[model samples]
Target: MPRRCTRNRRLVLVVLFVAALFVPALANAEPAVWVVKGPHATVYLFGTIHALQKDDPWRSPKIDAAIQQSQTLWLEIPNVDDSASMQPLIMQLGMDQAHPLSTKLTPDQLAKLTRAANSVGLPGGEAMFESFKPWLAALTLSIAPLMQAGYDPSTGVEMELKPEFVKANKPVKGFETAEQQMRYFADMPEKTQIDFLSSELDDFDSAIEKFKQMLAAWSAGDVDALDKLNNADFRDKYPELFQILVVKRNQKFTTQIEDLLKGDSVSFVAIGAGHLVGKDGVPAMLEKQGYKVTRE
Candidate 1:
C-alpha cells in the first residue's frame, strides 16, 4: 500500500475552505488567491477545499471583492449542486458488477477495509462493497470518517459560491466535465486501484489526523506545509498516478488559463487546493509559462 493513497483521497473528496480573515502578505506567503495579468485580462486563481465543516471560517473581504470584480466563475466542474446528474455518472464509472471487490484484495486487506468501514458506520454491507470498483470503494471508505466528523460536501466552497454567482448572474464554467473527472480514477490500472484501496484502508486512522493538519495548513496559507502533506510522499511513491491525477490536469488547466488571459474579461477560477501547490501545481506551471502569479 502506498502512503500516498490517503492524501490523494483527501485531495479528491474534501473541499478546502480558507479562513475569512485576511492575513497581510509576507515574503514566501501562499495566499489562497493568486492574481495573474494577461495583456487584456486579469484572472484570479483561487485554490479551494471541496468540503468543509459547517463552522469553518470562510468569509474573507478579499475573496468577496474578487468575486464581485469577476464576471465569470470557473470551477473544476459546473452544476456541482446537481448531484442527481452526477450520481448516474459515478455509478456508471465506479460500479464493478462483473466481479466482486473481495476477489481483488487479500484476507488482511479485506479485514482492514471492513474494520474501517464499520468504524465509520458506512451503510453498506459486504454486498455493497462488492458492487463497487476498488477506487470507488476506497473513496467511499475514505470519506466516511470525514462525514462522521461533520464535513459536508454540500457545504463546500463550490456549493457555497455557486448560488452567489448565479444570483449575481455571472456565468459559471468548468475546466472538465463530471464524467471526465470520474474517468481519471476509473481508467487506472487495476493493480494501482487495488493498491490505492489497500493503502487507504490500512491508514484510515492516521489519514484523519493528516486531513486535520492539511486543513490547518490550508487555513494558514502555508503552501510549503500543504505541498509537503499533499505531494511529497505521493510524488515519490506513485509517480504514474500523480502524473495522471495532478500533473496532466494542471497542464490542461494552464493552457485554459493562458487562453482566458488573452481575453479582456476578469475570471475567477476555483479548483482544489491540491492542484495549486508543488512544482507541478497550476501556479508553478503558469509561472513556467511566463505568467507572474502573485498572492493576493
Candidate 2:
C-alpha cells in the first residue's frame, strides 16, 4: 500500500479507540444506551470514551439511573485506575532491544515519525520512539496530541463511573486483562505494524481535526455518522484489524453477555461505542440472537 493509504488506515484505528473512550454529546438525540432484555435478566449497554475533557457533557438522568439500578458493572478492563500494574506488561510487549524501530522504517518515514513525536512535545523525538514497537509508537503518538489538548485518560467516562460503582458497593468486572489487550498489538504481523506506524506518521497533522469531527458525531448520538466516520474506512481498508479489534471482540463479548443474561442480575456494561453500532455491532448481533435490544 502507498504510505498515504497506510497512514489513513492507521489514523482511523486511533480515532476509533480515542472516540470510543469518551461518551459523545448527544446534542439532538438520546445518548447511545441500549437495553438488552432476556427472559431472566436485563443488561444496560452504554458506549464510552477512554479519555475526555473535564467539562464534556456526557451524563444524563437515564444513564445515571441505569448506573444506580445495576447490581454489576462490566468494563472492558478493570482497575483502570491502577496504571502501575500495566507498566511492566507494556515494556515487555512494546520495547525492542535487539532492533530499534528506526531500522524498520525508511529514512523519510523515520523523519516524519520524528517530526510527529516532536510536534506532540514527546521528549527525545526519534530517540524516544527508537525502542518501541511500531504499534506502541503509533498509539503513543496518537494519544499525545489529544492529551496535549487537555483530554485526560483519567477523566474518561470509565474512570469517572468506576468510583461511583465502587462507592455504591457494586461489583466491577472486565472482559479482558490489560495483558491480553496489549498482546493484540504485540502479536500483529510485522508488515501490519510497519503500516500502522507509517499511517500514524502520515495522518498525524490532521488527526486532531478528524477526532473533533468524530467527537461531534458521538456527542450527537448520530450512529450513522459514527459508523461512517469510524468504521467505514477501517472495515474497507484494514479488514484484519477491524476483525481482530472490533468484530471478534464484539463476538466474544456477546457470548459473555449471553451468559450474563442467563442470570437474574441487572448488569450495566460500558464499552467503547465503536463496538455497539453498524451491521456487526453488539446491538445488531444481540438482536440477531433473539434478544430484544432497544435504544434508551
| Candidate 2, RMSD to the unseen true structure | 6.4
The residue pairs in collision within model 2 are: 7-199, 20-49, 21-49, 21-50, 22-49, 22-50, 24-219, 25-219, 26-219
Query: Please, what are the lDDT tens digits per residue for candidate 1 over residues 1-296?
Result: 56444433333342122111111122333347889999999999887766666756665777888989999999888867765465566558877788989998899988888788778765554555887888788777666677778776657778878888999899999988877877777899999888778767876888778787777677778888889887787788778877887889899999999999999999999888888888988899999999999988
**Clash pairs (backbone) in predicted model 1:** 14-50, 15-49, 15-50, 15-51, 16-49, 16-50, 20-59
What are the RMSDs of all candidates, in order? 6.7, 6.4
Clashes of each: 7, 9
TM-score for candidate 2: 0.90
What does candidate 2's lDDT look like per residue over 63-159, in tens digits? 8889888999999887777765666676688779889999999999998988888887766778877888888887878677887787777677887
User: Estimated TM-score per prediction?
Assistant: 0.88, 0.90
Residue runs of model 2 more than 4 Å from their true location after superposition: 1-30
